[model samples]
Target: MHMEILPFTIAVPDAIIDDLHTRLTNTRWPEAELVDDWSQGAPLAYVQEVCEYWANGYDWRTRETALNRFDQFTTEIDGLDLHFIHQRSPHANATPLLLSHGWPGSIVEFHKVIEPLTDPTRFGGDAADAFHVVAPSLPGYGFSAKPTETGWGIDRIAGAFATLMSRLGYDKYVAQGGDWGAGITTALGALDPTHCQAIHVTLAMGARPKLDKELTPEMHHALERLQFYRDWDSGYSKQQATRPQTVGYGLVDSPSAQAAWIIEKFWAWTDNDGHPEDVLDRDEMLDNIMLYWINGNGASSARLYWESFGKGTRHVVTIPSGFAVFPKEISPPIREWVADSYTDIVRWQRYDKGGHFAAFEVPEVFVAEIRSMFRRYRPGF
Candidate 1:
């Protein structure tokens, strides 16, 4: 099959920006949550403040220019234009690395880490630690064309990504991801072992609780966190999985609705003190939201959950895999829980800080951990 790759740039039309502003101005807000904390949802006041800043203070052109500094392209893969940031390293020996983003995150989450990973020497690190980074906005998210058909699940997405690596002329590569990206990366490891050599992830979606044996304190804590997620944090998941189209109406129409939808996750999932702003400033947060709003990706993105939520059959990765456990991760799965599925566990590092958005929350640590896992697997190592 002949794949056509074309250079792509982020140039949202002025009309779109104007429309967003108009929508923000005429937003019909609801009554404030009756709670003091974020237990109910993103607070009415905070959402309003962010929307006001988004309308007046945020500068899309400036952010667009910064993102355009990296080379981006779109290639037709499996009947969809897959958008990706392909930043090659100066070092001749740099290994190919594929980074995938999950829900509520676009390629914006990788902005801080891409350059550092690609050109480590510029960041005062060894060039040997460098990677030829290929960060792709997943199907139905960001600038990538959304799936019109129903079967774009994890295994299929993994296969498409493998085809992407081949088309990029990379016969071998390492992959990393978090959240839904983790599921896709795991599938890539199992399904494309011929090309995808190793995998690293923060989330292990296939992990099942060990109820037949005695549970340790770490396991107990992890289970409790899982329970908490089921009780409180998973409402969005349920809604998206069951009725994405229904929620997409609000998310696509109202900029404030989209902002609140994603911003709530940043606040709940990050290792922040009280608010998401403590970890990510308003610009950084809004930059991500614009990917959804600009593309009107609310419905398309949520449809990924509907497509693959309970249908993941790919597990038991045979390729070398690494798992980074962040302290405040939604449910920090211990090695034992995931060991059965991710068989060739090469490295499992647990950190005291950070959360689900590892790359965005702590780029330095994320870069170092990535380098550590893939260094030994580099060509001719």
Candidate 2:
């Protein structure tokens, strides 16, 4: 397929900004019942402060230009226009690596990782370790075209990305992802195991179960953690999987609603414990929101959860995989359980800090781990 490069700048019409501003100015906030805590939700004062800034203070032009600084393009992959940033390393023979992002996330997650991954030498590493990063917005998320069909699951997307690599003239490349990204990356490695050298992911989420033998202390603890996640943290997934469009309507229409939907998860999932600013400032967080809003992907992003669930694709990923388990990810799998499906468990790291959005929450840790693990497996280009 002939690829169509994205315009240098995405045109955000004045009316849309005006609409956002008007909604912010005239928001009919919900009633508070003598609540001083966050149990009710994000504080009205705080939301107003953020909305006020997003309306009047935040500068989209600056972000827009910054976004365009990296090369962006869109290509048709499996009937969907897949959007991606193909940032080539200056090193002539940099190994190709595909990085996929998860829901409530965009390619914005890689902003800090780009320089480190593309030029490890600058950050005290050999030039041989640099990667030509190919970060793609999943179909129905961010700049990628919304999935018009219902079955755009992880396996389909993995196959699509396999074709995407081929489209980019990359016969072989490495793959990495976290959260939903991990699912897609696993699928990529499974679909085209020959083309993909190896796969790296953030915890396999409930992708492991071993009853054949006794569990080790660490594995037992990890299983307990997984149980906690499934019991307490799966409400959002259930809602998204069951009724994406219904939830999306509210998010797509109300910017505040969208912000709350995505922001709360980032806060809870990241090692932030409600204080999101610890890992990323409000501006940086809102910039990610802008990527979703500008691309009109709130609904489409939710569609991914629905798509994957219906197809039952995520449960079967046959790939040589590595997982970086962060403390805050919902469903974490232990090494033994992960080894049930993935034979090649070359490297595994457990991070005390960091969460679902590892690339953004802890770029230094994530990049270091990526470089450390892939170096062992990735052959010179």
All candidates: CA RMSD (Å): 0.9, 2.3
lDDT string, candidate 1, 192-211, tens digits = 99889999999875688778
Q: What are the TM-scores, per candidate, against the unseen true structure?
A: 0.98, 0.92
Measured on C-alpha atoms, candidate 2 has an lDDT of 0.79
Clashing pairs in 1: none
| Cα lDDT for residue 275, candidate 1 | 97
lDDT of 2 by residue, 1-381 (tens): 556555434567878777888877877776653687555556666676788889889887787777777777888776788888888888767888999888778888898898888988888978878898999888878778888878788888888888888878888899999877888887777778888988899857646577689878666766776776677656778888889888888788888887877776766678885677778887778888987787677778888888877565544446556788887776556777777568778788888887889999899998888888788655443
Residue 271, model 2: Cα distance from true site in angstroms? 0.7
Candidate 2, position 151, lDDT: 79
lDDT of each: 0.92, 0.79
Q: Write down the worst ten-residue block by lDDT for model 2.
A: 1-10
Superposed by TM-score, candidate 1 places the C-alpha of residue 291 at a distance from the truth, in angstroms, of: 0.4
- Candidate No. with top TM-score: 1
Model 2 TM-score relative to the real fold = 0.92
Count clashing residue pairs per candidate.
0, 0
Whole-structure CA lDDT of model 1 = 0.92
